[model samples]
Every structure is written in C-alpha cells, then in structure tokens.
Target: MMEADILIENCSEIHTLKGPDRPRRGDEMQDTSKIKNGALAVKGESILAVGSDKEIKRDVEAEKIIDASGKTVIPGFVDPHTHLIYSGSREDELAMKIQGKTYMEILEEGGGILRTVRATRKASKQRLLEESKARMDRMLAHGTTTAEAKSGYGLDKKNEIKCLEVIDELDKSHDLDLIPTYLGAHSLPPEFERSEDYIDYCIEDVLPEIADKDLAEYCDVFCEKGVFDVEESRRLLKKAKQFGLKARVHADEIENIGCSKMAAELDAISAEHLVKTDEEDIIMMAESGTIGILLPGTPFMLMEEKYAPARQMIENGMAIALATDLNPNCWTESMQMVITLACLQMKMTPSEALTAATFNSARALDRPDIGSLEKGKKADFLVLDIPNIDHLPYRFGVNLVEKVYKRGEKV
Candidate 1:
C-alpha cells in the first residue's frame, strides 16, 4: 500500500480537468473530466492518485484523512489576469459609471487608471505590500491558489519596479502563487505627451531593467483606442519579446481597432477583454493558438450590454479562457462570480466557465502544473460546500469554497 501525507475520500465529485495538454478548444471545453464518488491522495506537494473513493481508500493510507462525503472537489482557480498590486480603491467611479460616463470618458477626465496610478505612486512600498497582501488573502479564501498579477498602475520605471517587487514579496510571503507581468504600457501616463513616447520610454528604459532584474515573466499592453493603440502596443510587446518576456494583450474591451488581429500576428499567448472581438479575429487567434481570455467582470462592471462573443468563439474552434480582470475598475476576487457572469452574460456553460477559470487560465499564464488534479501535478484544489459541479455557478453570489489547499497543505 502507498503511504500518503493526506487523503480526501468520498467526495461526491472531483473535477480533475485532465485532458489535452494544451488549452481546450471548441467542444473540448465542455468536458471537465469529473470523477463521481471520488477520492484523492496527496503525497508531499503533488497529487499521488485520483480515483473512485473505494479504490483510493483500498490502495492508500494517510496520516490525515478528510471525508468530504457530500461536497465537490475541483482544481484551485488560476486567474490569468489581475492588477492585484494597486494601493487604492475606486468606489467613487461606480457613481460616475452609473451616471453615464464611459470608461474612456472617466479616464480622459483623470479619474480611471490614472487616478489609481497617482494613489499607488504616492503609497510607500510597505503600504503597498500591506494592501496587496490583504487582497491576496481575500483571493486565497475565495479559492484562487494561483494568479497572474500585472504591474500597470505603476507606469514609470521606478514605480513599475516597485510594483513588481511588491508582487515578488507577496509571492514569497503569501500562499497565493503569483506570476508577475510588466504592464508599463497599460495607458499613456500624464508625464508623456504621446502614447508613442510612453511606449518608447517603456521599451528603451523600463523593459531592459525589468528583464535584467527577472521581475516579470510576461509583458502586457492595453490595446484600446483612447489608451495605447495597436501599433504602440505592438512595439512595446515586440520589444518585451526581445527582452525574453512572453506577451499578453488587453485587446478590444471597448472597441476592436484591429488589436486582436495584431495579437494574432504577434502570437501573443492570450488576448484579454475581447468584448468587441469579431469572427475574423477569433479565427485568426484560433489559428495562431492565442487564446481569448474573456473578462465578463469588466463588461459587467462597465455596465455595458455587449460581452465577448464566447459562444461564437467556441463554435468557431477558438480556445477560450476566463479571468476577473481584477483591477480598480472591476474589483472582484471571486472566480465564482466570474463563472456566474460567464454563464449568464457570455452564454458559456458552467463546465466551460470552470475549465476556463482553471485549465485554460493556467495556459494563459503559461503554467501547466496548478490547474488540474492529476498524478504528479501540484496538489492545489478546492473542496466546495456544494454537492455537484453545476452548483458552483448555480449557488451564485456567495463563496462555495469550503476549504482551499495549496501544494498538499490546507490554507
């Protein structure tokens, strides 16, 4: 018999999400690879075995045993996109959005990303660490064991490095595993006259420093009309590529503007906020293997009626992923709520949303170890209060995560 460090038995269901090594596309997203009346054993920091409850109990002995008799078990969520290091809140902007101000309108009025940038820049490093650690605690409690955090609120070299440093500290000190991305081209800072000039600054100055420090693994750009346009986004991302950083794009949230197409051309790993993505961009991304990371929270918070054409993307054979887009504008820690929004607003099925939140989101961040429950994978998973998979999205508004485990240890 195999000795186990921990054994969880008699779970009503376990969504292993074991399938293709790559991101799920088309009909592939629907299959969650569920095991009914399931059990799993954890040995150190990896999954030892997963099978039917009786089979696992008969084969393995453990120091600690948990009987999750009526609960669902699933992989801990992997949020591929989040601005988790910012120092301030934007509650006042909620009223502005309600009073009929567009996101760009609020930004042009000096009250969006720039507002948060000012607050973040003014905050001491310790203060920023304190604030960000609190958010990480919230995210962990909400069942996100791993996430991709972006440094966009800090646009300049000094502040950008500070933000990445905070992320590094958080990763070391907090249980939520963070993959940092340098997003200095999120918007045109007030100090720069043109978006092109800001891109130049980020390319010539910030990119090299960040790469040398090994602070961020990915480089992201906001490809929007009133923000950095496609060409500017292209230059920054390409330069980031030259500096050994993988690329991600904030594409077509408010408008198409050829950003998704440009992302396909650049072979960005993922394109986020594809609210306005058309069929051509979808097909191009499918061919280029660039997954569309749909952020339902962003559109829901923006109070916009149009969401990403998820059903169309799925039908057209494009792989899809989901994220919180957890910035000042969206402000959500719950992947559960994001799943609800994906199902109700974007028309993604519950399983598709779950797959997107876990498996595909891992692919978005280029991490393969944390999003599935399988032998040799990292033992990161959630024990939900719910009895079945559908209850994940069905039991909306409240947290269903009864317990969260990271690397074989409960957290």
Candidate 2:
C-alpha cells in the first residue's frame, strides 16, 4: 500500500473525546479516554490512526511529518448554536443592563432581538456575509472548525431567505463546516407585533418558501415569554418538520415556561439556553435525546441572574453542549471565552468542558463525524500553544490555540 499522507508526532498530550457513547442510565457522565505523548496518522482528509508515538510510528510511513513537540492536541471545537450573521450591536442594551434593566424589559422597549431584526432586514446580503465571515474568521482562530449558524435576525420570508443564503455562500466559500438553521420564528417582526399574526406569517408564509428552497438543515423557534410561546412554537416547528427540516428550539432562556418540555415532546435536535428550565425538563430532554446547549455568555452579557443548570443536566444523563450564542444582542463570537465561562460559571470539569465544546457540540448540530479524532472521521483538529489541555480553561483570558487544521490542511 502507499504511505500515509501526513503524520503528527511527538504530541505532549492528545485529549480525545473519541466516543458518541451514551452512558447506561443512572450512571456517571460518559468518560473519555486520553492518550499521553500521542501521535496521529492522517491520509488525505481523514484520520487513519491515533495512538502512542511509538505505536503510530511503527504503523505508518508518512510523506509529511508534523512535529507537535510542545503542543497539546485536541479535536477542533464545534460551536453548534450561534446567530453570527446578524447586523448591529446591542451596546445600548448592554448599558441598560448595567443599569439593572432585565432582558424582558429591553425586549419590551423594542431593543432586544427586534433591534437586530430591523438592522439585518435593512442590510444587504453582501454586508451580512462580509460581517459574518469576519466573525467566523475570529472564531476559527480560536480553533472552532465546525459551527451551526442561525438565520434569526431575519424573521420575515425574504430576509430569512437572505440570511440563509448568506450562510450557504459562506459555507461554500470557507473551510468551516457551517450548519445552517432557519429561525424565522426568532421573534415577532415589527410589522406583525401581535404574536398570533407573527406565528401565522412564519408558518403559513415564510417557512413554506424556505422549505421549498431547501436552504436549511434545521428549523428553530424561540419559545420564550415575549417571543413565540410553547404552543405557537410547537405549531411552527411541527409545520417546519413537514418540510423535512429537523427541529431545534431556543427555550427558557429567561423564564421557566415549559419550553424545554415542549422541545422534548417535539423531539428537537437540541434545546438551547435552558437558563430557567427545571430538573424535570432536564430529565425530559435527556430522555428525549435532545442535547442541552447552554449559553452562559448570554446571561453574562445580559447581566442576568439565571444560567443553565449544566451540572443538573450532566448529573441527569443529558449530553450538555456549550456555545457562544454569538449574536448582536447577547454574546460575541469567542469560543475561548465561552469555554472559560463554562468552567467558571457552568461548573463543568475541564475535561467535560472540552468534550462539550468539541464532540457534544457536533452532536448539537446532529453532525457525528466532525467532532472527535478517530479513524474515518474528518481530519479536523487543533494544536494549542499551551503546555497542557487543562490550560485551555485553567489559564483564563488567554489565547491558547496556536494552529488549526481543517480537512488535514492547516488554515
């Protein structure tokens, strides 16, 4: 046989969360196995073998050898929930939050998601694409290789299609594995301030066109107090599924209104922002196989008291994921900062946090092959300048990623 195309050798540590394994019910969290001083073999765009340096060395002859002598290696981070394509910033809203204004209060003042909706609807696709591309570049530098981007800033039909088209163009033009989600029900558009009219417009007018175009892999609804409620969100997502899109939800970020339970009942791919969900909802999500995407950054940026019950979810056997929730209104697109917040605020172990960012994040997008380092998986991974994997979250407020590889090629 021909030689392997590339070999990465002399790794100080290789943290591999190499399983899509679900633990038996009533057990501790799924455990990941690590290989110390590891080496991995790659051919073309796929991992061929991963083991100790000696083992991998004996197994393959390689045309190109990468000396990862001083670096820690881990699969690239996957951010599975973000609204990175939106226009405008909520800096004014941020200031209001500092003055003790709640998220609901700001939304009531037409200053939260709707503010972004107005700005995005006004901007051209070229502008949105350029801005979103720059944001993705920043995220890539932080070692995010696969990301799920939402089209929530455009709540109407034409603008929703505009946002998804931008996402599609970015995916075609960039190395990042961009998973697109249609979020036409993010909030009530200014034109249709009434909830029922907005819901009708989303389900009857907007979703049909989006579905006909086959532009998105999943459909999402924001099931919150001021946004689409549980019943309305369910109706929208139910209709979205008829168009052959998987379901996802923005649920219970600021209130415990059974959005999580609805997500479970609807069998959503993932439920995001469970800041106000309770133990029963967590169990429901776990039982329903819906990944919990916790966005602590949003709560932090909004200056809110509530955060997702990550520990409770973990203990309850739920697969927990952490994402930037990158958007104009909440978080900026910085996966490193999000990880730090996961550890400090979400109370995840360093290992668990890394797993959440990498493998579980891919799971959040319903993508199995891009998250872990393994044979037959995509050759996407990152090298850290930090001395150890623990430093990724331990050394807070630092840029530890040194290099990123997508499809076996450095970017």
Q: Per-candidate TM vs. native?
A: 0.98, 0.95
Give a tens-digit lDDT track for model 2, residues 140-180: 88889999998988877889999999999999999887989
Q: TM-score for candidate 1, please give it.
A: 0.98
TM-score for predicted model 2 compared with the true structure: 0.95
The CA lDDT of each predicted structure is 0.93, 0.84
lDDT of 2 at 258: 95
Candidate 1 on 50-147: residue-level lDDT in tens?
A: 99999999999999999999999999999998999898898988998898877678878878778999999999999999998888898999999999
- Model 1, CA-based lDDT: 0.93
Q: Cα deviation in Å at residue 318, candidate 1?
A: 1.0
